[model samples]
Target: MSSPDRCPVVHFDHHSPEHAADPVGAYRKLRAEHPVAWTEAHGGYWVLSDYESVFEAARDDYTFSSARTSYGGEGLSVTIPKTPMHLHIPIEIDPPDFRKYRKLVNLITAPAAVERMLDMISHYTTWFIDRVIEAGEADFAEIIGVPSIVTIDWLGLPVEEWSRYSSAHRATLSAVADSPEFRQAVEVDLPYLSKQMWEVIAERRLNPADDVISFLVQQQVDDRPLTDEEVFAIVDLLISGGVGTTASLVGQTLVWLYQNPDVRLRIKDDPGLLDRAIEEFLRYFSPTQALARTVTKDVEFRGCPMRTGDRVLLAWGSANRDEAGGFENPDALDIDRWPNRHTAFGVGLHRCAGSHLGRAMARSLIGQILERMPDYEIDLDGLVPYARQGVNIGFHKIPARFTPGPRRLPRDDRSG
Candidate 1:
């Protein structure tokens, strides 16, 4: 033994029950005390906590190389294929290969392109709220899960499949992102995901539409039309990212808002405040947590030596709460927070593709909720906020009670 005081490496078995059952207290020590500590577990990976380190790690891909595709300046972990036919499309390819899929993604997630989906998004937003209003009480996970579920609607697919996909995605995430057990399980479900995406791709190929799937099927990269497997793989990546991250983030947002009424009232008073609040929430909660990368060569992060071929982990979620050079009271919910340089969606060439839309959807919901249910209060006893030890961070359940507020009743006696 090297003795307790000199032990530099801290290993975390994130998949352990303790990780989910209780994390804040478990994580607080690491977040504050060990900002750039290395980990002995998870195949001897490093754990980055401070915002500067995490952001630096995310931005410097050469040092913290991604396992997948890189966007304008961000990247995600590559989904390791257990079997040969497991599939590695947009997300598994790095750099040049990553860029090819990124171009197609940029076109679909563009402001104008997303703008076209606004009406549908808003319609579903209102409808989502109405579902809760009629019930008088609801699990925000199921009711306000529109922005994510409806995103599939944008793909010209049945939103009804959300539950199944959600289940499979969560299972797969747990298997691959959390522990070896989940990885083994993921091997079984991944092929099924490919089949599902193939069905959608085939439908879009026969009848091309303005939808993303259709655009993908008709797209050509490197003078070659993307293979059906490639298209399906990309689709699977997009679907999983949109639904999983958004759902968890939204669910976490609701619970946080309910817990902090002062922040809630600010948005309720000035609905426009959500423009900033949405960003702040993403910064504060940072539901996606950490992502992994491989070290291409020996490098040092802010004086810390990192070796080549090392498995490094970027704790994006915890970084947002670092005491030094990070957020002030990073743990608190501040709707008016600015200069909030939190790396929630990540940084570098793989920054989140649908970040703008995620903010828009969040803003839209905050607007609707404040207007309709200003007096809404979450059931603290029933507030089963999401607690995950792996891939994403968010709510599994957020029970809320919607109470009608004082408002003028519309006069419709003779209205046509």
Candidate 2:
């Protein structure tokens, strides 16, 4: 056995282009060799690559704290090198305190709320699809990125500035961590978006509207109206959570479907199978890659000694592909696979609160794409995936071509 003081270590760069291109293969190798390996990247940390370990760690909040500033006097920001502007609510806070903030935003993304947005989602999806249906070619990311912004706008932000905020959000997703572009997004773009949200908050306070911003402004916590900071935090969380990730899923799903015509035909023939197919896609291509948790106590997990203040990465993508994690033929795309308990939306208390919204958006968008542009073919040579795949895996561009189709919208409806 390896000495407890000197555990086996491996140098795995999760952010490299090679890993980003084929994260599943990279993680599969790691899972086979070192299911719990210590990496030297980002000032050294433990990486849990197997499903059992990752799931367990996510559940044990006491052992693996989610706080950016943990009780052990160390910052446990989810991203490596840490984010410059790190004030994401609920996700960044631990239990007891996490419950209040989570409750505030839960209703916004609950099933009923998301169900109500379906007609709006379908409208926006059709509107965007109509723009490219007659073009014969378009970048799928650019085409699909707008609807989420429109959804957020309806939720009580400025719809007119959707382009600006959406661009900022997309830039942040595509850029490498701490890069100039990423830094600009964090320091400049996000603050500007926050300012806009604050203005909306001010307006909602006086002239309340039937929107999320107005609802948030009127919400009380502990017998007091939620403070400006709390409200801002919630809105920021909504903007960040709702914008790019759903688009990424839809875009990536398109890329996958275009490549696998057999699976595409299966879903196309049987529309009822699309939901299960979406779940399989989520399991296969876990968009939000790995989330960080700080070790709160000294513990020996899988023979690796974890000290307090140590940051451990729970590789959710790896867990979804684990062969022993309850799924048969883990790597294969089995759309009919039932009881898929994948960690695509994460697990335990911090499972993505926007899961309902994300699912609805993805289903609505992809369904519209299949219906309108069923013959669309991806330009394999023109595909461009994001360079970094640590926090979020998404496409920079996915160019595609299709037979020209008639515009679904009337000329009057086209004029925005």
Candidate 3:
């Protein structure tokens, strides 16, 4: 057992160029040598790379808090190098109050509710594909427009502004905080989004609609109704969640399928195998890589002294690939891996409420591609990956070519 002051230390920076270059290789090294090592980056924190350590820490919310700032109290944010942004309700708030916000969000995003949107998800996916099918080649990263439209439509925001949101978010997540791209997103794009959201929120207050905005405006917390700030925060969180990660997974999976024609052929021949394949992809190429939690008290965790307010990064990507976690040939992408308990959507009370929706959307987007562009070939040399993979691993551009095809349905047809 290592003493509090004599624990293993490593100079690991998740946002560094080295990490972005080869994330899995970097994490694999950490898991093998120092699963629970201390790092001096981002004002210092512990990186939990092993499956058991991350799983246990995530479930023990009381000890490892997610609060950006405790409800009505002073605390640290979830991110190691906390971003200057609105509170991500439910995720950045601990239980009790966390449940209140989570429950409200869940009311609309539950599995059954997402099931209701499968056709809609498929419709948008097909529509996006239609735009590119005739061209014979496309920048596949533009598939993000599907989720952007779906998310804004769900929130009752103007769907035409989907590209703005998608591009801004992609920029924000792909760059380090100090980078010019990140600055542009934070200073320019986010403010515009907030303004637009506020306007819609005001409109929803007077004339409610059958959408999330109206639903949120009428909800109450504790004995009183939620304020405008609270409403904005929740809505912002939803947009952030809805727009980015699923699309990242889709992009990564597309690249993987292009490289593995055998797996692609199998999935195309039997659509039933897709869900399992998506699971394996999720485990293998975790989009949302690591999320941070603040230690609540002084204690020894995984044989290291964790003082109060110390940031601990739970490396979900590493955990999924942990061989000791019972994942045989952990580095390989096994589409048939059953009972796969990967933490891609995280674990415990703070597990993503939109997991069902994300999975369904991935299904529709990727399934449509396999069906429509069965012989598509990626331009690997032209691929442009994200400059940073600290929080998410994704591509900025995935250029590909396939045989041209006719549109399956009219653009304006909801039932198409």
Candidate 4:
């Protein structure tokens, strides 16, 4: 057994182009050799590649703190290298205080609330498909517009500006850190998004409406109503959380389905099969791949020495594919895989609150593609995936061709 001072170390950078290209192969090798290997990348951290370590660390939030209280404090930020942006509430804040903000968020995105929005999700899905039905081609990544529109519309932001927010967010996640695209997203695009959010917040303060923004503006935290900063943090987190996640999953799954016409036909023939297929795809793609946490104290975890203020990354993507995660053929996609408890969404308290909404969005968007564009074919040469796969994985563009079809818009809803 390795002592606290001399645990195994490895060279690993999750955002590296090589890992992005073959993340599964990279993780498989690491997990096989050292499930709890230490790495000196991004100021040094540990990577938990196996299922058990990742799942337990996520559950034990006290030992693995998520709070990013200060730049020079014991508290560590969730993202490696830390972000220049404001702290994301709930996720970045720990329990007790975390639960306070999460309560409000949960109410906003509860399963029932998301169920109520299914019609809207379907409508927007139809609208986007209508745009390209006649042309028989689409940059399929644009389907992200569906979730983008629903999220902003639910937040009571201008529904029409969904494309701007989604585009900026896509660029931000898809680009390499400090690159021109990244700078544009952070300095230029994010500022625009924040400005728009704050504007609506101001409007809701005086003229509160029946929307998430108004609901948040009127809510309390720590015995007082939320401040502008707090409100922005929450709203920003929602947009950041909702915009790219489901869209990425849907985009990747679409590509997979195109390559696996047998599975695609099976899903189209039996609509019920899509739910299980989605679960399998979630495991395979793991759109929200891994998340970072700060070790709270000096301790030996999984036989490795981890000190207070040390950083650790729980590789949810790797965990999903971990052989011991109790799935048959762990590396392959199995729509029929039963009782699949994948950690595509992080486990424990921070397990994505918007999971139901995300699933619903995927069902509407991908289901429509399989139904409307049944014979869609991807332009493999034109496909563009994100350059870096840090915390999220997504495609920049996926050009596709399908037989031309008529717009399926409702007669009275021809506003698109």
TM-score of candidate 3 against the unseen true structure: 0.95
Task: List model 4 lDDT by residue over 1-416, tens digit each.
Answer: 22246369887899888888988899999999999998877767889999999999999999999888543233227767666666678889889689999999999889999988889888888888888899998899985578998888888988878878877776665578688888888889889878888899999999999889899999998789999889888888888789998999999999999999999999998889988888999999999888888888888998888888788899999999987998778978888988899999789999998899999999998888999999999998898888988778878889999999998886467432
Q: lDDT (0-100) at residue 167 of candidate 1?
A: 57
Question: In candidate 1, residue 300 scores what lDDT?
Answer: 70
Report the Cα lDDT for residue 109, model 4.
Answer: 88
- Any runs in candidate 4 off by more than 4 Å, and if so which? 1-6, 69-76, 410-416
Q: How many Å off is the CA of 328 in candidate 2?
A: 1.5
lDDT of each: 0.67, 0.81, 0.85, 0.86
For model 3, residues 111-186, the per-residue Cα lDDT tens digits are 8889888887888898889888999999999965788788888888888888888777667666776678888888
Q: List, residue by residue over 273-306, the lDDT tens digit for candidate 2.
A: 8888888888988888888888888999888888
lDDT for model 3, please: 0.85
Off by over 4 Å in 1: 1-7, 21-27, 68-89, 174-193, 299-308, 404-416
Q: Give, for candidate 4, the lowest lDDT window spanning 10 residues.
A: 69-78
Off by over 4 Å in 2: 1-6, 70-76, 178-180, 412-416
Q: After the best TM-score superposition of candidate 2, give how far the Cα of residue 90 lies from its true spot, in angstroms.
A: 1.2
| TM-scores, one per candidate | 0.84, 0.94, 0.95, 0.95
**Ranking 2 against 4 by lDDT, winner:** 4
